[model samples]
Target: MLRRSAYKNLQQRASQLQLKRSASQSVASIYFPSEPTAPVLKTESIPGPKSVELNEELGKVFDNRAAYFVSDYKQSIGNYLSDADGNKLLDVYAQISSIALGYNNPELLKTAKSDEMASAIINRPALACFPSAEYGQVLKDGILAAAPKGMNKVWTALSGSCANETAYKAAFMYQAQKKRGSLDFTHEELSSVMENKAPGASDSAILSFEKGFHGRLFGSLSTTRSKAIHKLDIPAFPWPAAPFPKLKYPLDNHKHENHAEEDRCLGELEKIIKNHPTDIAALIVEPVQSEGGDNHATPYFFQGVRDICTKYEILMIVDEVQTGVGASGKFWAHEHWNLTTPPDMVTFSKKFQAAGFYFKNPDLQPAQPYRQFNTWCGDPSKALIARTIYQEIEKYDLVNKTQEVGDILYKSLDTLLSKYPTKMKNLRGENFGTFIAWDFTSVLERQEFLDTCRQYGVNIGGCGDSSVRLRPTLAFGEEHAKLFLGIVEEIFLKLYK
Candidate 1:
């Protein structure tokens, strides 16, 4: 009934669709052949029986108040997280965005079971003083291989907080050393340091942006301006907090307004730097402000900040704790900024497993040994895991795949969220791979949405006051995205229809 050309066109279209579907399935299948095609909800409710009982038991020995459900890590596969009650939910939170590849990935499992990993775990050396011979090769192959442009050296640490705190220490030491150039410590300086006073204990501060979440350690907590709950009753330094731009969503529609907002924030930042009582040693910022609310700014805004920091001679530290390891459609989220020069120090931890700050400036290291000393400088076991993660990511071209999946997911979300503007708004992370978010109308509305997501076998997470953030693993393919979107739409229909 059709002309030859029309029939050919139809055939071509069908073939393309089949190819897309095949590609989507193949990526996930390559990593997790046994991965469930859809969420398997065995219990009538999440935490049905076993999970609730386990949580109650766990509460006696540990703080289980925040336990969504007792996760069965052994049963989890690919993007699906299994709860104690045998409920397999497609997990987009991905252990607060820490899981880079997937749950129980075979490659990671093999790495874990290897003799090298076992030796590192059992014979864990105090890395700074007595690092194993293989340590250098391990770092070279893994962390160093993935370092951002212009960074060649790394100072490893224990956690995200430790990474930022150490970077802060480096900044302060570097500034002080520059000030005390070619001069040995004065007697006054020596005596004053013991008393935690000026000259020895530098008065310089690390500046952070408002609504930015750095970490919870003492020094890092002082820079963290996210939530009061994390800082209550803790003694914090009097560090200046500058405003971060509050850009409006649908970025294309509000280009002028967003640009103006960024300029205003940058101006305020310079003013704060100029007026702060103490010298500002460093300014640490998150590329996306994950915990604070997944806040984002344009490349122009970041370039402005970089220029200001350079002019002021203050160190610029980019905290990529949550936004690193290919989640942002780039290895490092700041790569999107295309800055004239890389940040002075870039801290990473969440997805990489190994926590540290990378730098090109050898001067950042203290002139004297034991000045930056720690017992276990960094764990080799974690480094081994990191090596495996990097190898797998590169082997599969997972970053590109993540970008492809995120493009499809973002487009689908844009279309779906457009119909429910009253219930949700401020959709963000457009081109950012699986790093998407949307804000609900109210805190209660957000809570209900998150609760409903779990009810429908989707383990999601929230940030800031009322924002749902998607932090799926790198293995999260188009199939996972489609499943997640369908569940989200089902939740919307049930709640808003």
Candidate 2:
């Protein structure tokens, strides 16, 4: 019935569809040959009897109040997470965005079982005092290999909080050394330091933006301005907080307004820096404020901040704890900014399985030894895991793959969200790989949505007040995205229809 040309066009279209399907299957199978084709729901609810019982038992010895369900790590694979209830859910949260690779990745399993890993875990040298000879090669192959542009050195730490805290220490020390300038410590400085006074302790502060979430440690907590629940009764420093831009969504529609908002925020930041009582040694910021909210600003905004920091001689620290390791379409989220120079220090953790700050300035390191000393400088075991993660990411070209999947996912979400503008709004992370999010109309609605998602076998997570974020693993393919989108549509229909 069709003309020859039309028939040929149909055939070509069929061939292209087949190729796409085959590519999706190939990538998924390469990472997880045994991965489930779709999520398997076995329980009536997420914490069905078995999970509830296990959580109750876990609570006896640990704080299980936050446990969504008792995870069965052994049965989890690829983009799926298994629970004690024998339900397999698609895990977009990815252990709070820490799991770089999918669950029980064979390569990671092999690394875990290797003799070198075993030796590093059991013989665990105090890295600072006596690092193993292999540590250098391990770092070179893994962490250093993935260092952001203009960064060649690293100071490994224990966690995200520790990384930021250590970077703060470096900033303060660097600033103090510059002030001291070839002069040895005075007797007054030495005596005042013991009393925790200004001459020795220094009155420098680290400035952070409002709604920023750095960490919970003493120094880092002082800079955290996210939630009161996290800070509570704890003592905090008097560091000033600067306002971050609150840009409107559908960025294209509000380009002029967004640009104006950013300029206002930049102006406010400069004013804060100028008026702060103590010298602001550093300014720590997240590329995308994850915990505070999945807030974002344009490259122009970040460039402005960079210029201001340079002009003020204050160190700029980019906290990439949740936005690093290929989730942001780039290895480092700040790469999107394309500033004239890189941040003075970039801190990373979560997905990398290791925590540290990368710096190019050697002066960031203390002039005297033992000044930055710790018992275990960093764990070689985590470094080994980080190496495997980096190797696997490179071997699979996962960053580009994630970017491809994110493009498809973002487009799909844009179309889906158009019909439910009242129920959901402020869709973000358009080209930011899989680090996307959308906000619900109310906190209760968001909670219901998250709860309903689990009821349908999807383990999702929320941030800020009422935002759902997608933090899927690098192995999350087009197939996973398709399945997730379908599940989300079903949930939306059931809730809003």
Candidate 3:
């Protein structure tokens, strides 16, 4: 019999061989054959002179305060982002997690070039009133096919914030209808609505958790409790926010304590739902709380939330905008919870290239036709692209493969972070695919680390006050993960040690 060390060495070697074998067949390779194998640093600094000049020119007409660099999209490919300076950086941020397949994916370009796409773009239909002949098939074959379990209907919107705001409208309308109970609107109700008063304009609210970020729009901003800057100087709705669990690091080491913390937060949530001044028609929550530090709670906490929503008869919405489309090791992050009842609506946008909410209940559709109406209700071009993305994901099984790659990345990161425990801490998102994040000692440290990362030819992003997050595209594979790990470890050793 071989010794334990020999067996472990053999296992490691086998894993390396497997990774190399899969690299040739990776989705990135299949789609982006011309993708760069490693980052190309041509300039001493990121946002080099050419990028700075272009951005300065762009700033004359547009707000480019937050611009990292002027990107050359034509030159960008696969998991790499190219700047005006002709420097190609390994982009784990992936345009803030929106690129599903990759930059300039051939299949997406094919869809863009098709006659149907050109027609959709040139003669964009006002979808609600003049939906194209292929609209139903488009929904059926694409977005609806990828819907979360127990969801079959979709109300498409223009963006993530729009998707959330529309979902709120649906919830408010559904609840109002239930209260109306077959009665027609009274003259007083009709007249009061013009004044934006009660009995017409709803006093109902949407409940979200602390450290949660829904969006920056008027209605969604009320539910967005992530940052003061986003909400400052904006008139926000008087909505309620409940506590989200503050789980400890290395979750396995603090299981009992974390459970207690989650329960406490759940209790507070129940109290808020029962006692808020306004009716909470719906409660929206992010699975990983992306913008708010990537906070995570166990399935127990989510299941508890599901139970609470059921008891209160309030709609439960899962905001999968950042965690959706196979990034979380599942098509939807809520799929990890295995809730007894599915979320009332699941909102998606970022990666899918289309924004919408998925629901099963017919009641969610407003009683009046134009109640949910708008010009250009949804973009057909985006829908066509979403269809291609769905087909590709299904054909390639990217979700499961993402999980395998994430497992390897997370374990390697865990080992790396252990060497600098104080410098980096609270690593989270285990078993949640590539949807991973961790915190630094302070906000400055995190920012410096991000700046250092970009300087090293790897573009990453930060979330919340003091956390670094990895929002790699679904096309990311073991090869990409290894490169990323190596870069990060090198940076950590140089800076922290």
Estimate candidate 2's RMSD in Å: 6.3
Q: For candidate 1, lDDT tens digit of each residue in 1-497?
A: 11234224323433444424344464667778777766776776786799999899989999878889999999999888999988888899999999999899889899999999999999999988899999999999999999999999999899999999999999999999998899988999999999999777888999999999999999999999889999999999999999999999899999999999999999999999999998999999999988998899999999999999999999999999899999989989999999999999999998998899999999999989888869988799999988988998898888888888899889999999999989899999988887899999999999999887887778999999889999999988877777677768767887899
| Clashes per candidate, residues 3 or more apart or on different chains | 0, 0, 0
Single out the weakest 10-residue window by summed lDDT for candidate 1.
Answer: 1-10
Clashing pairs in 2: none
TM-score of each: 0.95, 0.95, 0.95
* Model 2 per-residue lDDT tens digits across residues 12-109: 43344442434445365776777766566766567789999999998999987988999999999888899997888889999999998999988889
Residue runs of model 3 more than 4 Å from their true location after superposition: 1-25
- State model 1's lDDT: 0.89
Residue by residue across 27-78, what tens digits does model 3's lDDT show? 8878876776667777778889999999999999999999999999999998
Model 1's TM-score against the true structure: 0.95
Give me the runs in candidate 2 sitting further than 4 Å from their true place.
1-26
